[model samples]
Target: MDKIDKQILAILQEDASTPVAEIAEKVNLSSTPCWRRIQKLEEDGVILRRVALLDADKLNVGVTVFVSIKTNQHNANWYSQFSNTVKLIPEVVEFYRMSGNIDYLLRVVVPNIAAYDAVYQKLTQSNALFDVNASFAMEQIKHTTALPLDYAGLN
Candidate 1:
């Protein structure tokens, strides 16, 4: 939460696998203190988890589709069922309940239109939706997992 902690976070965000010694050097601290800070960050839930970023194109699931859904069913049972159904679908990488014209939104990744069609069919069959609209993303202009740290305002 201090300047040194923020610096450590910036370094870890850039590369989670960065050696403790290197990070310590960059942050102008000895290895032990820097490591302790990192450990504290993890224990405090600031560092949730470290993961490897995969190449979707190489994995044969590069195509992205944004699905907007509208549902008339507003009961808890219906919401629970629908949320569970969506969570079980592997193609649905991101799902959210929105407060707008659209009831829900999902970002689905698939290899081709046929695969997306299958996902669409599964969704429609599993839930009673008033409307479902999907738009294929032609390009990914900006995509990043790194979060903005300036908003924290502790640096």
Candidate 2:
């Protein structure tokens, strides 16, 4: 909420495992206040979860593809069915409903193009996918899991 809180958040974003004493030192606060602030931030739902980021390549998930999907029907029942089915698919890491030509966009991770093709076929064959188009990510120029910090003015 204040400058210190913001600074703490920034440091935690970089590394959630950062020690309380280190954070306090960085933010010019004592250990107890810093720990309390972190606890309060969690209770307030400002800090969601602390997780370790993994290397996709090392995990045998080297390829990332974005899939644009359009459904035959836009009804509530249809959406419910579609969302439920998509959520169960392991290859689909991210799915988004958008205000564009496509009804949904999905970010899929796989080991190879063949694996992606198989997943794609399985997904479309089982779902009400009217249209599907995929674009592979050639290079990840700037990929950050962190949210933008300029949301102070946002409502």
Candidate 3:
């Protein structure tokens, strides 16, 4: 991607709902070229998907907890089962297969601790986890859904 593409991405990350004409103005490009660039970006999979980010608190999913899970059985079958089971749980917002101290990390969102516990009970009983540890977020200092832009070193 060129400088204009990078600029377009940055603007879109901040607000995907931004008009093509506005983006063109911001990047000092004409509407047609700007629209073409955006189309190219999307076609090339640079711009993945556009989504509406909803407020968790307003949606009654105020509590967020990080759950770290470890399983003694590290086989492919076990991993597949675990992943499938976790995906079925709506409360689990994000799940990552990790390295080091944790095998898998899950970001869970619910109404409160009691609701979390209910989800927890369901998870453990699902035959996917051998051990699970959860940590609740006391305060979110910096939470961003945006990825960092490092274009300086790029050739």
Instruction: Tell me each candidate's RMSD, in Å, in order.
Output: 1.5, 1.3, 1.6
Query: Model 3: C-alpha RMSD to truth?
Result: 1.6
Tens digit per residue, CA lDDT, model 3, 10-128: 99999999999999999999999999999998999878999999999999998999999988888988778778889999999999999998889999999999999998988888766
Query: Which clashing pairs does model 1 show?
Result: none
* Candidate 2 regions with alpha-carbon error over 4 angstroms: none
How many clashes in each candidate? 0, 0, 0
TM-score against truth, every candidate: 0.95, 0.94, 0.94
lDDT for each residue of candidate 2 in 36-123, tens digit (9 for 90 to 100): 9999989999999999988999999979999999887889988888888889889899999999799899999999999999889887
How far does residue 17 in candidate 3 sit from its true spot (Å)? 0.4
Where does model 1 exceed 4 Å of error? 153-155
In Å, residue 108's CA in model 1 sits off its true spot by 0.6
